[model samples]
Target: MLQDHLLEEHAGPAAETEPALVLANAQVVTAADSFRGAVTLQAGKIAEVTDGGAIPSGAIDCQGELLLPGLVDLHTDHCERHAVPRPGVQWDPLEAAIAHDAQVAAAGITTVFDSLVVGLRDADQTRRDLLGQIMAAVEKGETLGLFRSQHFLHLRCEVTDPTLLDQVEPHMDHPLLRLVSIMEHTVGQRQFPDAEKYREILIKLFHVPPEQVDERFRRDAEASRTFAPTYRAAICRMAHARGIPVAAHDDETLEHVEEAAHLGMALSEFPTTLVAAEAARECGMATIMGAPNVVKGGSQTGNVSAVALVKAGLLDILASDYVPVSMLSATLRLTGDDIGLTLPQAVKMASLAPAKAAGLDDRGEIAVGKRADLLRVRLVEGHPVVRTVYAAGDRVA
Candidate 1:
């Protein structure tokens, strides 16, 4: 049985008086169109959208800013950093959750999945110890209405860990658990095709000695070979049985994409090569790339360029990854002349596409009857800055 105390099924704010809202003189970006329009919100849903310069009486003047659907981030590592802000410092669990929530809300993410590692192979004891604590914190915060954005859980299972299955089972029935992704970040495979680069990255990330890197990599690789295949299958079965969406992480080959499709994965997260992404699309799996990758112009690890994939029409969704602000930033960047995506198309990737992929059908668009999660954004010096945010018809930021 799932832990009842640790899970709450979409416990949103209780019934209350929610005032109607209206923002006129804005560029309303929807799932299929972008038009100069006004959006009206009533009872926590979009009541109406009027096209072209029709400013209703008592409506807030948006002053020709972009009124976009608030972003839906399928994956973000932002919260974990707050859980342990520094190498040895650990903040209060609930405090960490609220702090992360504030940042994500300000970044225009109305819905976010907090990515938590189910298992870790390295010597990051702090992270390993804080996983359950953070999960509990998210639940507690949601129940208490402490979060500004809707939060869900995305368990990133590190298949190389022998204890991965054990660690994952407890959260299988968590109400907030919406996504599970099987990952094998062992070295010289998947995300780390270049072993030396992987070593350097891990050295900096874990602050380990150079001399100890090779031995650790060898052990990790051996462990992955021993446990990954079996654990991957088991984790997928568990997630699928529970009706949770499972994603494939860092797929780097056609074979990898094929296996993920065979396992019935719904998303290919950060496929490391163009071939892999193309294969994922062919296999009918939606491809998700890091928003930071687009913002930074390329993958930090020298994988396939997200811009290249977008130009090729192979990318379907954008995840904030480690940067909460990158969701809107990347969405706007995709609309530039170089990328060539229209404003509506770019907004859909960050909002509607991810929401639909994660089984969130009620929000993610500025259409009538959808949840009123909207962002008022203005471009100042070519940077998209969010001025106001509304989630469920309530002003959150």
Candidate 2:
């Protein structure tokens, strides 16, 4: 059962009253088309999408900006950044949740899945210790209508953790739990096949001595390899039994893609190579890449380029990953002449495609009867700045 006391302690405000909104003088990008139009919001849903005209008479002028559907982020670690703002510092769970929501909202993410880790990598079990409190705060805050954007849980299950099942067992029935992904970030595999680079990255993250890096890597790798395959299979089965879609993380090769498809994985999160992404797409899995990778030009891990995949028409969706603002910027980048995606097509990857991948049908587009979540955006010095954000007819930022 959930800890209601934790929720009560974290609960904040209630939902605000929504005003009927009319977004006018913008290029409305829908799944089907981009046109000079206006979109009307009433009762928390899009009431009308008018092409080449103003909406009624009280429409708010958008100054010829780009109007896009609210972005749906299937995976994000930005919340975790709030939880542990820095090394040895843990912010209050409720405070962290609220702060994270505000940041993402300002970045035009109207719907986000807070991808919390299910296992801890530290000796003190920092993540395990904070997981319950943070997750409770998220659920309670959203339920109490404290969040501007809708929030749900996306458990990033660590397949190498021997206690993975035990850690995950409690959250199997969590109503807030919407998606799960099996991950094996053990280094020298999947996302990191370069041992030296992995060591350097680990040193920075843990602030550990160079002397301890090699020994720790060898030991951890052995342990992870011994446990990963068994735990991955079990995690997939449990997630499937609960009717939750499971995603494969950091796929690097065709074999990895094939194995994920064989396990009935619904989404491929961050395929590390073009071959893997293409294979996943051919296998009926949606290929998701980090929006930051696209916006920043390439992966920090030196993996495959997202733009390369997009150019090949192999990329299906773009996740905000660590930077919520990257979703919009990456989508916009894909519309450039080199990328060749139209405004509407690129917006679909950030909004509609991600929502569909995560089994969300009520939101993610500007169609009639859909949730009135939209972004009023403009390019200032070639950077996409969110002028305003509306979630369910309520202007929050």
Candidate 3:
């Protein structure tokens, strides 16, 4: 009945109110296949997809460009770059959100799970308070129809930080808070297994003095040891109660994956070893890896490579992580050069896989009943460029 109603509504005089966006002569990457066809979008959902080229009155000729489902980035810290344009320099939350949205949209991401860090030992009170402000701005922008993509919050909780639970308490009720990633950034494991590499990254990114880096790590380690267990338990309970999808970040061992799975986390984000990824698969948890890892040939943090995981059949979904443009690039890279995957399979990592992992079923594919979140892209010199972006049938970029 719903499908019938949608067809009738889309085909009837209501079409006069809603302009039909007919994409013609395009290679459409649908779930089943990639075919040269015409797609008609009306009222923010796909109205029809047909092989016979029946050009509508106001059709836009794609001229054989590749059209794929809009990328759904499951994890990214790109918003932090906008919030803190430069170290110690802050922009208005709304402005930062808008800028981040524009960058993501231009990169062909129609849905973004903005990873906002919720814990820092030495962070100022104002910095901790900024999370609510940022979430509010995202909500306002979405409601106002000012953003190009649908934005959701993925609160990255530093399990080692004593104050993380407190910081997130008030905002757990927010509807946009769909995913919670428990991260333990202790100096000895996960991301910074090598302390020297950790110090080097700190100096490069945060500009911390060599002496201060060691001192900071020592202080943070003590705090982490003291507070990690309790903080992790509280956040897990809260997230579970709220029906939020919980993920464990950089899990390194089978024990680590087991503990997270027992705690009700259904996703493993960037597990550092094959043991952990395999354990996640066995536990029926979705494993998310970074797209940059696939494109750049390895993990920047010296963890297990995503390509290796994929080779072992352990990789489930790919997130953009820190690079918005890398989603499409990594998808193409995964398809291999000589005998690449079909477009449908290649697009899945950046679209349906991430969406299914995040429990977002309204979009991430081209279908009659799904949201009209789509992207028109063209490969230029082996790189994917966003020609146009649409979220719920509205052109944003």
Candidate 4:
């Protein structure tokens, strides 16, 4: 089983021949509780987790640092952040992906869903131009073992775009395409529920001329109304057939949640309103929120609060979103400062919850028979910092 699940290999270090690693004498956080324990890793699996058990003489002593399951980030646009540093500056695809990998691993994300843009809007041809090259680079990087963390692709499909299917046609059989999300960023809907705020965001981030903002919004709204429904249905059906989880993005209204439920969406990514999130949960769809939103105390685009959703018993998974470091920070914060949840609960939200959301059951928990993907975190000055990362028992960061 360990051999079957070992990571893909090429030129870099492989877990197959790596010797067993034992992280002993740490405060281990498991799914059910936390204890001063030792974890044994061998054959790419967690061999044991024992409280005050006999430690191997060769074990690496953790010295009471917090040892937790490696975080699983369901959505991180940090790849795109590295690919495009400034608004218009494009970096080398391979270099950006490598840098993103290091940042992600160092941030303690052992498994990450790289949110790559898949849109057909002519308004952003540059984004489309980089799509193929970037994705290829990511695949090559992974196969070559260039990334410390396990990487997967999360295609953020722009349902309102005219050539949405065309943009994804060739990659239909891509192995890394584990997730697909239906999203519409049309100015007046969902994510941009308020037209004025949407216009301001466009003028600021997108550099849209104020005089042309209304025209662009109107055009996008028209495109959304005409194409979104059909594209959503078709793309969702294809994703379901391929065994890839589909998520509805920026859900705002009850109707949006109902539509996503009808289409069999397994998750709702970044619902913009509390009502939408509640509706999604009621329909049995897992709700995913950006960890950055929790750390920042609000959304950049003025959406419903993630922390509020967590308090309401609606949030199911947490994604790194735009900040790789936000995952660990948010988890610690959510577990700290009288946030109503214990450390184990918050860690589950960052790890097992997201792993299950992505249909990965082999990892995400510090338990016997699970992949030995783990992290050693220490708190200093009221902040959580990742000191070490292990992927399948191999120390990668």
TM-scores of the models, in the order given: 0.95, 0.93, 0.92, 0.94
Q: What is the C-alpha lDDT of each candidate?
A: 0.89, 0.86, 0.84, 0.87
Tell me the spans in candidate 3 whose CA falls farther than 4 Å from its real position.
Answer: 1-17, 52-57, 338-340
101-157 per-residue lDDT for model 4 (tens digits): 999999999998899878847547777879888888888887677889888889999
Return the top candidate by lDDT: 1
| Evaluation by lDDT, superior candidate among 1 and 4 | 1
Models, CA RMSD each: 2.4, 3.7, 3.9, 2.6
Candidate 3 lDDT over 1-397, as tens digits, reads 3323432332224343687789988888887788888888887778888875455667988888888888899899998779888878889999999999999999999889889999876789888778788888887786666787878789999877777777889888876788999999878887788999999998998788887987889887898789887888789999899788899999998888888988989999999988889999999999999999988999998899998887788887889898898988988888786435667876887898888887777678898767788889888988887899877777889
- Provide the global lDDT of candidate 4 against the true structure: 0.87
Worst 10 residues of 3 by lDDT: 3-12
Model 1 scores worst on lDDT over the 10 consecutive residues at: 3-12
Better of 3 and 4 by lDDT: 4
What would the per-residue lDDT of candidate 2 be over residues 90-164, giving only the tens digit for each residue?
999999999999999999999899999886655476657798888889987976779998888999988777788
Q: Write the per-residue lDDT of candidate 1 for residues 1-397, one digit (tens) a residue.
A: 2323322223224354656678999999888888899999887778888898777789999999999998999999999899878877889989999999999999999999999988887646666778989999998888777888989899999998888887889888887898999899878889999989988887898787899998888888899889988988898899899889999999998999998999889899999999999999999999999999999999999999899999999999999999999989999999999889998889999999999999888888999978889999999999999999998878899
Index of the highest-TM-score prediction? 1
Clashes of each: 0, 0, 0, 0
TM-score preference between candidates 1 and 2, better one: 1
Better candidate by TM-score, 2 or 3 = 2
Scored against the true structure, residue 207 in model 1 reaches a CA lDDT of 80
